[model samples]
Target: MSARRIDRRGFLKTAATLAAPIIIPASALGLGRKIPSERITIGVIGLGGRGTQVLKDLLKLPDAQVIALCDVHPEHHREFENGKGPRLGSTPARELVDKAEQARSGQPGKPCFVTGDHRELIDRPDLDAVLVATPDHWHAAITLDALRSGKDVYCEKPVTHLFAEGQAVYREVAARKAVFQTGSQQRSDALFQQAAEIVRNGHLGKIRSIEVGLPPGYDKPMGSTEVKTPPAGLDYDRWCGPSPKLPYMNARHHRWWRGQRAYGGGVLMDWIGHHNDIAHWAIGEELGGPTRVESVGWTTPDVDIYDTPVDYEIACEYAGGITSRISTKVTEGTKWIGENGWLWVTRGKIKCSNAALLDKSFDRGEWVAGPTGSHVANFLNCVRSRAACIAPAEQAHRSITPGHLGYVSFSLKRPLRWDAKSESVIDDSDADQLLKKSESRAPWA
Candidate 1:
């Protein structure tokens, strides 16, 4: 399709339709009642840092309600209650309780129930959907359960810890016929959309390569620490859901677990998911994985706490001779290298090689300004209409595969070819084994 003929206006019109008001009958909307209005009642499965952020965002939508909240730590429940609890009533244990009380009394508040066991949360008949924001290893399993229960899902980025699980997520979403949106919110950002449109329309002619910068991996040395008994209210086994059990350490417990290989994929999967998503969107490949990957750097040599590469470079090849180079150590920004000129974008600035590329201004007179407003608006609209979300599961799966494949290559320290068709490594035993999930510990297993 010609760039100008791509119909930005029509695309925006479709987005507007997807952002239409959600309508539900007052009776159907009653809390503690049947799952109301295909307008999804959402359960947040991991109420830590990222999950809490998602809960806050979902609260803004009029049609959606938080039916349940689940986390391993009791401290998180305390924080959510102390901070947002009293506003609802006296002491509602979960967000759902508050929501139900508000509905009964005809008051304005969020309705959500709380639980430490995510399995109970997923099994709730009141829930129409779930948001999975747990560690990398737990993402696939939780998502699968949510799907099996006939609920739509919004999972955090880097969707799967292993390449093999992507196909499972794909199959489950298709089989259940559910709406799955990946939390790669960049897809909902106007600036990112604009950037991708510019490249797609040949604003950057004959694109050569794209480079993305992620936060640097831990470059500091690991401090020595002794393993301690699991804390009183924290369900350590549940927290380690699909990952192997190890002695308790402060760094691997909460948010810092992103630095570990067992629970995270390091900076590559951690940060690259955003830009790689944009890169794939700009290139217009519907469903393609990287053909080859190689990496040759390390962020830290610490073998004690974390095992992911700290600093590394990876090259991914696609059809039509296009290549994307992602690095962990670059200054945080995204650069597009093309035959005609280049464009660089970060949160603070956007620059083009010719400087003329910046001269063109998008006619946003009719468009929304920020990402949070635009993206959330889109999802709510789709919930009512049963349309596709802007960042659907299939697209997210394709975008994230590059970073996961890159990690696999770096860990194996060899060139690996991937069959995007089969979502597997070609022929190499070690790489093939890394493609699937590693078994978690017992009990939680």
Candidate 2:
């Protein structure tokens, strides 16, 4: 049979025609294999830039197929649906199409289906797993739904917006016995893993403090602009799910959502999660939350566009007097300070307090193989093995807690006492409120 030319609109029409409560049978999806299966049917949610990259990675695996793609933006979906059919190339788009064609030719599997609403794809019996790459606000809800629907999940970093939600998600995953992986991909990189292992093995001596850095924030203010009509084929309401309804701007809609408070926790949660996670791993406390957090710094004076602090020094106190100071404006590198010496690490570079330590190269033989060759690969493997991923939901939630707490301290303009066990601010009602998410408008509610 000739290859199907289903586009985003066509896929949505198909999904609409299908009745509610669609059931996707596990047998039809062909999930799980003794070894890697010939084909692993998968679904893609939130097909923006990150979603597209993930799609490419899935295509690279010989056993995987992108059976369904979903996004709220019709234009974004159209961009993929109207693209040329399967062909070989280094680009993700090419790889996805090529894999789809491979499945259809009877050479291996089946072509992918595209849709606008992720709910449609989640209900598909033909899917082995779903990748949740939506904004931070939507992460917990979408993931919980997917897990409840009996699909394994590979969710993005800083897994939840609030501490309580993280706990709820942890309970849900545990109860369902679903395989879940958080998208803190740095754990899969060779250099990062080596650095973390070195610190954990006590090569860095008694841990003192960790310094984590993030890219600088925007200096200019976002001037007021009139609210224009929502673009065609875009479900703005659905896109803003779990977030307050606000005038649509280029920054809020696309990649710049990181700066917004409702959608993201700014650089603290975005960059600190990776670096702080490194510190957590190195300290051998990867599963627990920090005992305390304090922040000192400020962003631009304007409060219109972004409410998160742009520059700040946040400290996470752990057990045994070890502390990690996560900063957004610091030079790009991780510094581990201990009693004997300090080790500094960044991509392609490593340094030590004693110059001689830098000369001593470590052996790879002592290294334990991580979940996958890299972070994303690890998630895929965990879905099949039912093994715990390197950065599971609980671990990621703890890793980001310091950053979130730091932001709270900065906002409150005081050194707030944090109860790590309770995951709440001690005795402070206002600070306590920040630990939970506010109700979104109707529809999102």
Cα distance off (Å), candidate 1, residue 279: 1.1
Runs off by more than 4 Å, candidate 2? 1-38, 76-95, 98-100, 103-111, 221-226, 301-303, 354-372
For each candidate, what is the lDDT? 0.69, 0.68
- Where model 1 places Cα greater than 4 Å from the true spot, the runs are 1-6, 22-39, 76-111, 221-224, 359-372, 443-445
Model 2, 219-249: lDDT tens digits are 4443323457766667887878877877876
What is every candidate's alpha-carbon RMSD to the true fold?
Answer: 5.3, 11.3
- List of clashing residue pairs for candidate 1: 94-112, 95-111, 95-112, 96-111, 96-112, 96-113, 99-111, 299-310, 299-311
Candidate 1 has an lDDT of: 0.69
Error of 1 at 152 (Å): 0.4
Which candidate leads in TM-score? 1
Tens-digit lDDT string for candidate 1 (1-445): 4344435466657556555566655454222233346446778877666776676677656666677777777553322333553222112225544655486559965545677777899999878788898888888888988888877788888877766777789788776666677888887775676677667767778888888777777654332345889666678877887787778876566655767788887767777668878777777764776777766565554656877777777787877777877876555667888889887776647778776556545532222222334555566565554557778777788887777767777677787887887777888978878767556566544
